[model samples]
Target: MTPPAESCPALVLNADFRPLSYFPLSLWPWQEAVKAVFLDRVNIVAEYDRHVRSPSFEMALPSVISLKEFVPASRRPAFTRFNVFLRDKFTCQYCAVRFPTHELTFDHVIPRAHGGRTTWTNVVTACSACNLRKGSKNLRECGMELKKTTRQPTTIELQLNGRAFPPNFLHESWRDFLYWDSELDPW
Candidate 1:
């Protein structure tokens, strides 16, 4: 039996056949993919066995699609909580242990109470324990050391870090595009 329409999202690729974005694993709903196909904006690279039908025509659901025009990546990445966590590889700067997003919180290298502004250079990822332990205290006073220095990450750097953490669900066809540059041998 065919899966539900929502389950058959199409992996979206740029004109060059690379994914538009890796961290989010670019995808479009079947409806959007079909519209793009009809609009001549995208080429269907692969299809599912299941088909969608209208009054006059029927077509297979696109499992993979590539754009006809390439879209360039942004030069500067946004300074968001998630991006900060991703930039730090989700590892706590204080304890150097990786934690899931929910368990992680960002820290100000210099406490805001001490005039630190919430910018990329001043923020670092920290666990709940470390956050509380270093509350309102300067790094030197708390005697806590950061695993790595904090700074704004470039879009390319964030993308490279994001590659280490793949999404939970990956369609079989997406594996090739997603891991094309990964090492073959796991030595």
Candidate 2:
């Protein structure tokens, strides 16, 4: 069965040909991608086999698109739950175990009860068990050790970490743009 247009999202890249974001695997819905094409805001680097048509015209859904102008990245990554998880590589800093986003939680290295402020310097990704065990106590009190020191992550640091997690769905057309420099099999 043919998938719906909604399933056909286009991977969006900056003018430099790099993806706008890696962790989220920057993508735009088919409708927005088509609109961008019409507005000349982006160039279709690759396209899907499926096509959309109106009374006036028809065009293949864009599988990949690149911006006409470069978009600069922010110097500092946002201080959000997701970014915290990404900065820690989705691993519990205390136990050093990887978890799915749903299973992970962020914890204050220095518990708020001890005058810890909720900032990048004090927060770290943690598992539910560790968070519970360390609740309202400093790491020393809980006998827990951090896998790494907590600090604000640079945008580049987060971007590099984001590359470690590729989206589950990668269209064939996107592979070239995403992993062009990856080692290839001799055979």
Candidate 3:
């Protein structure tokens, strides 16, 4: 069966041929990828079996595309809920158990009532049970110890952490570019 054009998202890579992001698996909808192709902003690293057509033009959809120019990584990552989870590698800082995003929550090491600000250095990812148990109390009071010290993660650190998680779907062509950095076992 022919997959719809919408199902064929193109993996997007920087000029260095690394994905722009990993956890989200840097991708562009077929429409945007085709537009970039027409605008000459990206090079098609691979093409899908699917093709799109107009009255006068038809082109295979891009499965992977690389930008013509490199995009630099940010030095500082944003202090957002998702970023916090990524920084902690989606594990509960107290229990050291991994959970899906929906099951995870952020907890302030020093509860707000105790004058803790919601900043990177004071926040850690926690599962619901951990969050509730630690609610409105300091770690010492709750008898909880964080698996790791809470601190702001560098953008690069977050990026590397993000790579530890791959999106559920990956087109075959993207595999090489996505995991080239992984060390191979010796024969």
Candidate 4:
């Protein structure tokens, strides 16, 4: 039986067959995939067993699709809460322990009240405990120090860091494109 449209998202890839983005695992809705197929914007690399039909045509839902043209990634990664955590690899800069996103918070190395601005250089990821401990105080006043100096990470750096944390849901077709660089473990 054909699955619902919502269940048939297509993993989108670049013309080179590499995923467009790794962190979020680029995907497109079945409708968009089908539209792209009709428009010649993307080539269907794989398909689901499910089929969608219209008055004149019927086609299988794409499971994986690749663009006809390559889209380059931005050179500069955006400075956002998520990017900040990713830049730090979700590790507390002060305590140097890895924490899940939920347990992590952004901290200013120099307290904002002390004239700190929320830029890539001034922000660091901290665990809840560390955040509260260092609350609104300068690093020296809190007697805490960052393991590494925070700075704006390049797009490539962010991409590398993002690879360490994969999305929770990965369709089987996406594995080959996503993990092409990883070495297989010996049995």
Candidate 5:
């Protein structure tokens, strides 16, 4: 027999890595997501186009669902930014200036030649001019200072994976995590 479809829901986050909303992985454009809704306690508002019987003992029959629980502060979200440019918002990290995505380049705060690993904390997105001007040189040597402190990617970032921000992603609660914040969780 084929594996049965699942009704599991996914947790959503705000731009700041704050817990925002939840969605049944299946929910889409038709309706608004609700907060404080999760698991069997939450109701199933819709379903896929095909007909099927509700599975017994399932948590909820979610055509779509949003969870009620805010992610506990204790949970350290994973960072996802396979592309350095998206990780830095197509902006120069050192100068903190926005640029077109195409104009951005990868930068190593600590040059790999000098012991930098290819990790989020060590890298950033930089504009062409910024990258060229600081090429292969440490900030101190270039007499430049980074506008923001570089840190590991946040939970929201880990989910983004260099993909363009999803149009449908900015729902309730998620707004707090998606705007202005640079970090993200690996989905």
Candidate 6:
């Protein structure tokens, strides 16, 4: 497994929240969380430049980045909670009930026995009762309904990285041609 998002580092996004790529913790000068928050995409408009006298090249800053739409600038994704718990908000995605953290389990929206993969789209948070009853059966068979639509990873991975980063920070080295695009913000 990879290192923790905080210590392991984070990825950047475009102003539209499209994922760019991962960056290491030491590569950036700003807070880890802050980098995760602002990095939306790579610098497409501007290219990196280096000086002949200097050994280091310029940092590749974000031309524009997509900020997370649901959470606020103040909050970040919580990776420690695990993806299933994160997707279900720690509540049963089916049944509309809440359970103790331990009592909650991951349920396959599409049963694994039916060829479902262990992807974020196929699994969700569920209470023990709901999961057991729904066990490896199709939803139509059990008359169960999904609370929220399920899909694959969006910013979940990047959000996961940002949880441990510092606040309001981006790498200073990348500022050469990079400028914040507020209009592109709000993904």
Judging by lDDT against the true structure, name the best candidate.
Answer: 2
Q: How close is candidate 1 to the true structure, as a TM-score?
A: 0.93
Q: lDDT of model 4 at residue 72?
A: 89
lDDT (Cα, tens digit) per residue for candidate 4, span 1-187: 6568898899999898977777766888888999999999999988888899889989989999999999988899888999999899999999999998899999988889989999999999999999999999998888998999989999888877887788877767777777844689899
TM-score for each of the candidates: 0.93, 0.95, 0.95, 0.91, 0.45, 0.41
lDDT of 2 by residue, 19-61 (tens): 9999888999999999999999999999998899999998999
| Root-mean-square deviation (CA) per prediction | 2.2, 2.1, 1.7, 2.4, 9.9, 11.8
Candidate lDDT scores, in order, read: 0.90, 0.92, 0.91, 0.88, 0.51, 0.52
Q: What tens digits encode model 1's per-residue C-alpha lDDT throughout 72-137?
A: 888999899999999999999999999999999999999999999999999999999999999999
- A best-first ranking of the candidates according to their lDDT comes to 2, 3, 1, 4, 6, 5
Whose TM-score is higher: candidate 4's or candidate 5's? 4
The 10-residue segment with the lowest total lDDT in model 4: 173-182
Ranking by TM-score: 3, 2, 1, 4, 5, 6
- Name the runs in model 6 displaced over 4 angstroms: 1-81, 153-187
The residue-level lDDT of candidate 6 at 117 comes to: 75
Candidate 4, position 168, lDDT:
76
User: Which scores higher on TM-score, 5 or 6?
Assistant: 5
Poorest lDDT segment (10 consecutive residues) of candidate 2? 176-185
RMSD of candidate 1 to the truth, in angstroms, is 2.2
